[model samples]
Target chain A: GAGVSQSPSNKVTEKGKDVELRCDPISGHTALYWYRQRLGQGLEFLIYFQGNSAPDKSGLPSDRFSAERTGESVSTLTIQRTQQEDSAVYLCASSFSVFSTYEQYFGPGTRLTVT
Target chain B: AQTVTQSQPEMSVQEAETVTLSCTYDTSENNYYLFWYKQPPSRQMILVIRQEAYKQQNATENRFSVNFQKAAKSFSLKISDSQLGDTAMYFCASTLQGAQKLVFGQGTRLTINP
Candidate 1:
């Protein structure tokens, strides 16, 4: 089976620009998550969607960061007015549901660079 | 809220040798799950093993095993007969039962030397 896939494997943008990263979860997955991994750091949870509704958005760093999932399949993370601080690898993961027992399958992450 | 910590930032072991990576977590919830994930240079996160809070027996997958100490809140991963392919960043994560988000630890980079 195909694993979670993210589009635009690499992106370079100037500061103050906006960018959108896309994620395609597994066929039947109902839960999707977004995380940010800065260089030499751990994964930081950003937001998650359970069947198109985000139940936890507490991890979003600021108002400039937002994510949305539609049809319970594909998700998009948007960063408005990108800052150099936003530069990092954006990872997407999906699982069968929100259950802790289920394993989350991750994608090859899209590396975003802000200059 | 849940918090995970990996005391060791890096580890190196000779091929075919045994190695262990330590991880500790703090959480108020009694029912939860613990996981170990490996991220290679390709930046792909792969599930190495998982342990359920209620399960006393450690989880093992071939050469990878976890010593889960529920009472101490410590979950350590042991890799027996380490292989060069095992070289990567290992992260420990925990989440409450029925929770959607996971709290991750600062990864430990493991290197398998020949």
Candidate 2:
């Protein structure tokens, strides 16, 4: 079975630039999540989608951060006017359902660098 | 809000020896799930083991096992016969029974020495 996959494994952008990170969840997965991991830090919850709708967006750091999922398959995280503080690894995960019993499979992640 | 903590920032163990990583969490929810995830230098997060808060028995996966203390709010991972492949950053996470979000602890970097 295919695991969750993310695009643009590595990205370097100047401050104030905008970037988009993509994620492809496993087939049939209805739940998708996004997280941010700063260097040597723990994972910070971002946003999650159950099907194509997002139920939790409180984790978004600010208005510049947003995410969307379409067709209940692929998701995109967009950071507008990125700041150096936004530099980190963006991770994507997917699960069969929203239940806690189900394990979320993670993707390799996209390492975003803001210069 | 739920919070997870990893007291140890780093640890090391000789190959074929045993090592233990400690984790604690604070949550008001009674029903939840606990997990241990490993991330290697490649930056791939892998599920090591999981424990259900409602279960009394600890969860074990071959050489990896967890001592889950629900009363003390402690969940520790024990690796026996540690291998070099086990060298990585270990994170402890938890989520409510019906919740979709997880609260993760500061990772513990485990180094396996030969």
Candidate 3:
């Protein structure tokens, strides 16, 4: 329970359906990140949230992909009209707010399977 | 853009022995961080070790240590006295200054044989 927690350990969804993955980062961690790991591929950056700083949206793959965080706690990645190729393990990580370190604590990612 | 590469796709080591996993990266910045993460069957991504690019001394944590070659841009992880519990997927990652994006390698599948 102390580590970052993700909901729906596994999700099977129909193509063109909407799917929302929830991530509950460790308490007091100001920086939260979203990453996607496709089968046989490395993790790809998605979105980031820092306390009060504008969320970095550069890593977002497309306009259809969006995320939001409520007061630096629970964050959700919403995939609208999910496609089959969108299947992957979505990972969420959080780190203490430090200017010089990038050591992030990760969660057991949610495995999404779009059929 | 920075990228991490793990050349060894799969590695095997005898129980109680030592093995090293190789990782390389391409970066222009002088200051950054390199990390090795382990994902076991439980699927929890655990930080094995971390190294700051500017530090010359190697970072060590119990049985895990890292060999960092700054000029060569290589960061390798060495696991000593490997146990069955050490079998897992190991990922090498890098991140830059003033950013939260972590670039990761494809990961190496490690197995410890008894």
Candidate 4:
């Protein structure tokens, strides 16, 4: 089976521009997550969606970061007015459910460089 | 708040040797899950192993095993007969039961030389 997939493996944009990163989870995965990995840093949780429940946006660093997911399919993370600090590898992960026992499968990630 | 810590920033060992990566965590929740994820040069995060806080017995997956110490709040991953393919960044993470997000550590870079 295909694992999670992220589009635009690499993206470069101006500091003041806006960028949208896409993620396609496994066929039946009901939970999806987004995380940011700064250079030489660990993964930082951004947001996640579980089935029909409300998405958890607490991890969003600022109001400029937002994400949307319809049902259990695809998810898009949009960054408005990107800053140089926003440059990092954005990763997406998914699991069968939100249970801790279910392992999360990760995508290759999209590296965003804000110039 | 929950926090995970990986003390060793880097580790190196010869192929077929044994290496252990240390991780410590602090959390208020009594029941949680600990995980070890490996990120290769390709930047794909792979699950290495996982341990439940309530399980006193360590978790093992072939050459990959974990030393879970609930009282001490420590979870260490031991890779026996390490192979070159095991070289990657190992991240220790924890999350509450049924939680949506995982708290990760700084990660340890493990290099297996042939």
Question: Quick one: best lDDT, which candidate?
Answer: 4
lDDT of each: 0.94, 0.95, 0.91, 0.96
C-alpha lDDT (0 to 100) for residue B28 of candidate 3: 91
lDDT of 4 by residue, B3-86 (tens): 999999999999999999999999989999999999999999999899989888999999999999898999999999999999
Weakest 10 consecutive residues of candidate 2 chain B by summed lDDT: B95-104
RMSD to the hidden true structure, all candidates:
0.9, 0.8, 1.2, 0.7
TM-score for model 3? Answer: 0.97
After superposition, the stretches of candidate 4 with alpha carbons farther than 4 Å from their true spots are none
For candidate 2, the TM-score is: 0.98
Q: Write the per-residue lDDT of candidate 3 for residues B7-109, one digit (tens) a residue.
A: 9999998999999999999999988999899989777889899888879999999999999999999999999999999999999999887767889999999
Name the 10 consecutive residues with the lowest summed lDDT in model 3 chain B: B94-103
A21-84: candidate 3 lDDT, tens digit per residue:
9999999899999999988777898988998778988988888899999887899999999998
Chain A TM-score across all models, in listed order? 0.97, 0.97, 0.95, 0.99
Error of 1 at B44 (Å): 0.6
Please give the TM-score for the first chain of candidate 1: 0.97
Q: What is candidate 2's TM-score for chain A?
A: 0.97
Off by over 4 Å in 3: A98-102
Error of 2 at B9 (Å): 0.6
Would you give me the overall lDDT of model 4?
A: 0.96
Poorest stretch of ten by lDDT in candidate 4 chain B? B95-104
What DockQ results for candidate 4?
A: 0.86
